[model samples]
Target: MDKRRIGEFEVSAIGLGCMSLSHAYGAPPPRDQAERVLKGALDEGYTFLDTAAVYGLGHNETLVGEVLGDRRGDYVLASKCGLSRGTERELNGHPDILKATCEESLRRLNTEVIDLYYLHRWDRRVPIEDSVGALAELVAQGKIKAIGLSEVSAPTLRRAHATHPIAALQTEYSPWTRNPEIAVLDACRELGVAFVAFSPVGRGFLAGGVRDPAKLEPGDFRSGMPRFQGEAFEANLKLLEALEALATEAACTPAQLCLAWLLQKDPIIVPIPGTARPKHMRENAGAAAVRLTDDIIRRIDEQVNETTVTGSRYAPAMQASVDTERTPAEAAA
Candidate 1:
């Protein structure tokens, strides 16, 4: 697989989003099975693994540690801090919280130095400088390699970068999820920050895997996303039709086509498409080889245009947690 810069390290263009192995998307694959799947991803050329301290309250990081700890030198490990204990809504980016979180994550990941450490979200209660200053201190201490952010608005990104060079910015940047395009994407480009696209497959909705929200396993996060509920999903599914001809033309699955589209958008854009299935993992990694021509890019634009995208990335309460969009109206506007 080709590599892209996340900081000083060059990671696989198609990184594996390890959250689904234990956090979201219903019951995680059994431990023994998950180990095999993760190993399969590594064998399939994924040198980048993304997890978070908040995911399953550190369960995901532990799983990554247990599976790949022995081969620590094989991949670049990234995790996040700032999420309040056991909750998704509350954020604590205080220096104390960040220091404690960094130590705990190190213990769980079985790594002495986290390759990339991200302030998961902007905390309104905490000043951005304090949070980023702490991260810069961590780099000096050799506790973390590079610093990053998630779902930050353009101004927030600039402010954070001024405190410390933000190596990357992780956010939802799939074809259907265009929030990054509003300003965040361009800001990243201008500042030389690598843009890491999470949920690059639209939680698999854009891949033609999710037909109905009800079909998803109980407790799946997608059920609560505005784009996947009621008329929104029904309308969005129609967008898949626009992708059929292009997928056939590319001789790849709809999911690979989507990955190809993302990779083609910007050399700095790296998509971490997560899946516990070894087959799916291989499929996403293979997308790095998939190429898009001028015509295909135009077709993808038409596909996105064909669907009248509706709904917010999160529910109102969960939406409140995103710093990328200060208000629901602003996101829609």
Candidate 2:
């Protein structure tokens, strides 16, 4: 696999997002299967692994620790703080909370130091400076090697960088989710921070695996997503048809097409697509080798975009949690 820079670490161009193995889309995968996916990613040359404390309320980190802890030196380890589960999901970016969270993550991850630590969600109640200051302290103490921010706006990124250099900025970015284009991408380019694109395959929709939202597992989060419901989902599927044709022409799967598109977007962009199945994990890793032509990329731009996509990426309540920049139409809504 090709390599990219996330701060001082040079990792695979396509990293593995270890979320779905333990949390999110639905019920957690069986322990043996999840472990195979984790170990398979390393064997597949995915040198960067991303997980967060909040995922499955610490289950994800613990799984990663158990499966990959023994092979820690083989890859770059990244985890998030600030947002976690107590009695319920919570966001706390206070210095003390961050420090304590790091301690907990360290124990759960079974690692001495995390390679990249992120403030999962900017706690609106706390200033970005304070949150980043706490991360800076972690850096100083060698608890984490680099600091990262997720789902943040450009201005927020600048403020945090003013506090301390941000190694990376992660958010949901795919053909259908164009929020990052508003400013965060340019901000990261300007500040020399890497941009990590999560859900690069449109949250499994682009992979052609989720044809019916109703059939989704009982607790599957995508079932509640706007684009996966009723008329919105039907419209989005139409967009997917054209993308699938393009993928065929490229001799790749729809998921690889989505990932390759992001890889070709910019050198600073690294997509950490997640999956529960080892087969899909290998397919995602293969995207780094799938090249897209200029005309194909142009057609993809014409076919899928903010204006063409149906429904909001998140519900109103979920939307309010992120600090990502919004388009005028979305902001007005």
Candidate 3:
């Protein structure tokens, strides 16, 4: 795997997201199997691991800690906090709650200091400065090595950076979901912050594993997402056909094609693709080796841009919380 710089630390260009091993995709994999997948990733030279406190409600961190115990320094461990899930699945990011949450994450992760700590979501009630300021304190105390923000807009990113140097910004950025190009990616480039693309394969949909949305379990999170619904799902599958052709030509899987496309987009962009199966894990890791020619990249851009993917990335309520660009009057009000 290739290595890239995220602030001061060097990490694999393709990192493993440990979320699916615990939650979000489907039933949890057995602990031993999940640990094997993690170990395999490290053995294959994936030195960057991403997890969050709320992923399986801290169970994910515990699993990572158990697998990497005592050998933590061998990898760059990145975990997130700040989003509090209440009884009805309400997620909040208040500053005080973030402080308490980070402490809890430290306990669960069993680490003296987290390599990269992030605010999972922006709390509407608290200013971005306050939330980032609290994270700065954690850095001051040696609790965290660097700071990150997730699912935030350019304006909010600038405000948070004024408080401290943010190492990276985590968000969904795939061929199917290209909204970051509107502002977020440009802002990160200007500010010299790394852009971490989560779900770089479009939540496995772009990998050709998800041919039918109806095959998803009833309570699966993707079932509630718009892109996985009836007409939209069918329409999006057509888009994948173009990707499948390119993958075939490239002698790679669709998942790898998608990952390689993102790698070609920006050298600073690191993708954290998640999977619990060892075969899929190895396949994802192999994406770094699939080089894309300039013509292939241009073809991909043209094909993906021509197809209009249906549905919003976030549901209605969650969409309201994303701190996108709003006028000063709207922000103050």
C-alpha RMSD of candidate 1: 2.0
Each model's lDDT = 0.86, 0.92, 0.85
Cα error, candidate 3, residue 50 (Å): 0.6
Model 2 Cα lDDT, one tens digit per residue, 131-220: 899889889999999999999999999999999999999999999899999899999999999999999999999889889898899889
TM-score of each: 0.95, 0.98, 0.94
Q: Provide the RMSD of all predictions against the true structure, rounded to 1 decimal.
A: 2.0, 1.0, 3.5
Which ten-residue region of model 1 has the weakest summed lDDT? 324-333
Question: What's the lDDT of the predicted structure labeled candidate 1?
Answer: 0.86
Query: Highest TM-score among the candidates is held by which one?
Result: 2
Residues 1-333 of candidate 1: C-alpha lDDT, one tens digit per residue: 999998799999999999889877998888987898789888888999999998888899889998899999999999999984433434888898888889988998998999999999888888999999999999999999999999888999999999999999999877777778778989998999999999988898888878868889987888888888898788887787677668889898889988999999999999999887888898898899998888988878866841346666788887777878433333553
Q: What lDDT does candidate 1 reach at residue 112?
A: 97
Clashes of each: 0, 0, 0
Clashing pairs in 2: none
Cα lDDT tens digits for candidate 3, 226-299: 78888878888888999999999999999999999999899889999999899999999999999988888888
